[model samples]
Target: MCLSFHSFRKLIASVLFLTFFFTGCKNSEKRTVKTEEITFIKEGELSIYKPGTDVPVLNLNIELAETDYETQTGLMYRTSMKENEAMLFIFDDVAMHSFYMKNTEFPLDILFIKEDMTIGSFQENAQPLDEGSLSSKVPVQYVLEVNAGIVAEKGLSIGDSISFQKL
Candidate 1:
């Protein structure tokens, strides 16, 4: 069918408007992004030892957080951690480091270890999802995160040492 110039312009404008309207509606639809629950993967085995003792006080299957990304994301999305599991963050330089419980679902015991493999300091029973800074008062080369109350239950103390083997 033949149409006047003004009629054709109106038809084109109407089509354009409807196209944009539908596209906008489609774009505005609510979208839920499914996030997979993170699970614990054992990368090593670590033992906490009493001072000057050959026997270990506690042994754990450890997940090492060595890379920058791994260290930064340490145990953030996990729902729960088993009693025998832990995350050990290894840093290249021995320095005072601080941690927070951001995005973590469960409470934790954070142990700071010095270059000599001795526990330098610790923060026990850190609440979940807390943004408060948990500090290692002394310079440390490693940080160990375990289920909350582990330190107290195991009687872990400053000067306690650790040894680990990668699996």
Candidate 2:
């Protein structure tokens, strides 16, 4: 077939554009990732005790958040936690600390613990995904997160104490 030079160049350009477009789309499809749910990892055990008591009021399988990244990402993106499971954040400094639900998917009760292992303050029934600051309102070295309503259910109080051991 006889064709003009300009027409031949236009045909080549169109062919190249379509080829690139389809190839790009196919590559993107292959790159699509299926997100899986994050599961809990047991790292320790914690016990909460009543004031001046030797026996524990509650015991929990805990996931420790000791690193900067672990503390910052605490419970985020998890759908839910078991009633017996909790996340304990260990900070190096004893100072006023605060938390928020942010990307957390379930309600929680946050306990603020002093260096002496006593509960200093707590925020109960923190709403899921709320970005509002849930402050300790006191200096604390540890923060414990558990399923909402656990504090009241366990009869936990400010003077209650905690002891933990890593697995």
The residue pairs that clash in candidate 1, if any, are none
How much is the lDDT of residue 58 in candidate 2?
A: 97
In order, candidate lDDTs are 0.96, 0.95
lDDT of 1: 0.96
Candidate 1: lDDT of 9?
Answer: 100
For model 2, how does the per-residue alpha-carbon lDDT over 18-135 read when each residue is reduced to its tens digit?
Answer: 9999999999989977789989999999999997689999999999999999999999999999999999999999999999999999999999999999999999999998999999
TM-score of each: 0.81, 0.81
lDDT of 1 by residue, 1-167 (tens): 99999999999999999999999888878566879989889999999999889999999999999999999999999899999999999999999999999999999999999999999999999999999999999999999999999998989999999999999
- What is candidate 1's CA lDDT for residue 42? 95
